[model samples]
Target: MEGRQLQQVLNPQRLKALQEWMQKSSITLTQVNGQRKYGGPPPGWQGPVPGPGCEVFISQIPRDVYEDRLIPLFQSVGIIYEFRLMMNFSGQNRGFAYAKYGDPVTASTAVMTLHHYRLPDGGCLTVRKSTEKRQLRLGDLPTNINQVKLLTLLRMVSDGVEDVMLKMAGPKGREVVALVNYSSHYAASMAKKVLMQAFKKHCGISITVKWTSFSKSKHVSETEQEDGTSTPPGLNPFPKPSISPPHLHPQPFLHNVPAHPPLQSSFSAVGGPAGPPRDEMKPQGPVNCDTVSLLQWMCEVHRLGTPQYEIRYHHASSDGFLCFSYEVLIPCFLIPLYGVIQILPGPSAQATKEEVYRAVAELVIQTICKVSSLRPF
Candidate 1:
């Protein structure tokens, strides 16, 4: 089956015929010559062994699949206990992973549903119940990290992290390791991978993050709260408001564009080589080439010596709709234009370019009317 083509392995017509024959013959199609049966044990073998209820084995996973991509795929199936992508010494994926499901029944269901699942990259998955019932590993962190800080970081990475526990290593318990437990195994796996990548890329630190055996002898404690408060033993922490990082966080704006960058780089100034700004054009019900050109030209100019937000018009096209439509793109952020609209006569002998401009502007305004929050790129 490895070297042979699919057609050589099984012909459609013959396989259909064999299926009919088996139904008519009332006999189970157990084995073919030199080959074991599709499932079940061979002759003289004992009954099938039970799989570990919590774990799942996945194979033939695409090499490009990462933590962010993998979590969403399995998370919908059920809460996860662990998701470990096997890596080779060369620091590349080994094309397999073990995901532990919080619910044993859900783990089995995931195997049945996702087995042979087709990926966007054309790779098919092989999902099955794992035989090993091992403890999940802790994500390694830098030394001197406080338990409170560790808990905050893990929570920011994922909402599923349920508890945090720390352990000491080395002489005099000098070295520290934090154990993060998740409500769902999927969250634990995601936190490990995301934190590992974030630390390396943003903080310039290489850290070990993997599954460790769960132990009954270990002492575990609840995470600390925002106000330097600790949760009671065996209880979860209360929700706290999130704080945005100072950098990379942008101020609020109509289009959510980064305002610090010079507007010249993103928007075209009016009357120069760059096109005109949008705000300068007076609300003349209709417009001609001169009016539209003036409107386009007016965008770059500062209104009353004050800088107002500008919208850059690219071009206009019409498709027999009796209306000219235009698309505008802003730098740093993409905004769908929506605002005041002015209805004007359709393109006609008497209608001027200003009328067409107004129609397009109205259309733009209509499209972006509901956008309250702009997402920064």
Candidate 2:
């Protein structure tokens, strides 16, 4: 039976046989940093680097399943540009992998044909389009930092830093932010884990590292139109500037919200009227409030000065979600509020910032609403 054969193939004693099977099949896998990769574009023919939507995310793989089975199955759809299987120290797969093809059409075909396909062990595979994120947003940097210097410093600390773009941050443009593109998502992820500590130790400057949003509005719009679903409004209030300066772009300005806005109106929209009485009211769901508006309302009600955001760390998971460890400083409280949040990957820098802000606002509102003492009006 297929199941019995699979069990035999995966037995510890059969690893040599598996390797020999791979060799006989002309499949070469190289291990690197907890992943086993086949073909940096595949050994055979020449073509351009795979673009967006050319990769399919595969999950629900049986730990015993290796490329010897997966690669050939995928190749039945089309030529595989590359394949990577996440690995563990115990010599088994991490239950997920990515398969890239020569084009988006082929990737789509692989997803259509292989998704939910049953394995010999009765496990089904989950396959879908990959976002292919390869950029990191570095925030709270010095305004004087230049692209060349940043690229140099990043290279000293991380690998696959292909390009760096500088942007002005803060209302008066007093701070700088950098958008760093890596050769691959894996490289960017590894760099993100180390860049925060590396910068603090080497340059004595603390920085916020997060995945940069790559906009997918065009594709989303097309899909929505086909489904006859209405498009959502843009979360960011400010319009993007018409032009970017050389390698520098403008950062999201959080100070644009009026400082003296009536707090009652804001709370009314989120829950009921703002004040001590409203403290008991639970937010219906995610507060439909933007970060700037929420911060303004918080400062006005609590008498706390402008809050500070310090992203301690952030990383994108294989499932296309970004997780962040962040701190928010309230003037009235000596210690900053620490928490973690997960959000879907966004399409642009501004969109991503808005998502973080909205998430933080929801957290703040939920927290204060639960603890009346924290309101201290």
For model 1, give the 10-residue run with minimal summed lDDT.
Answer: 223-232
Give one digit per residue, the lDDT tens place, for model 1 in 1-377: 64355444343454465456556745343322211112122223342322224466677766545444454588789655455665544333556666655434456567667878898757998775542411123434567667787677667766566556565544455456655555433445445557777667755776666554311212322211100111111112122222222232222433332222211111111222112344543444334544334333333231111111212111222522222112232211222122222222234422423343444433332222223242111
lDDT per model, in order? 0.41, 0.60
Off by over 4 Å in 2: 1-10, 13-17, 156-159, 168-175, 204-206, 214-377
Among these predictions, the greatest TM-score belongs to: 2
Output the worst ten-in-a-row residue range by lDDT, candidate 2. Answer: 227-236
Please report the TM-score between candidate 2 and the true structure: 0.52
**Clash counts for the predictions, in order:** 23, 3
After superposing candidate 1 on the true structure, give the runs of residues whose Cα lies further than 4 Å from its correct spot. 1-55, 58-128, 131-143, 200-205, 214-377
Best model per lDDT: 2
TM-score per model over all chains: 0.28, 0.52
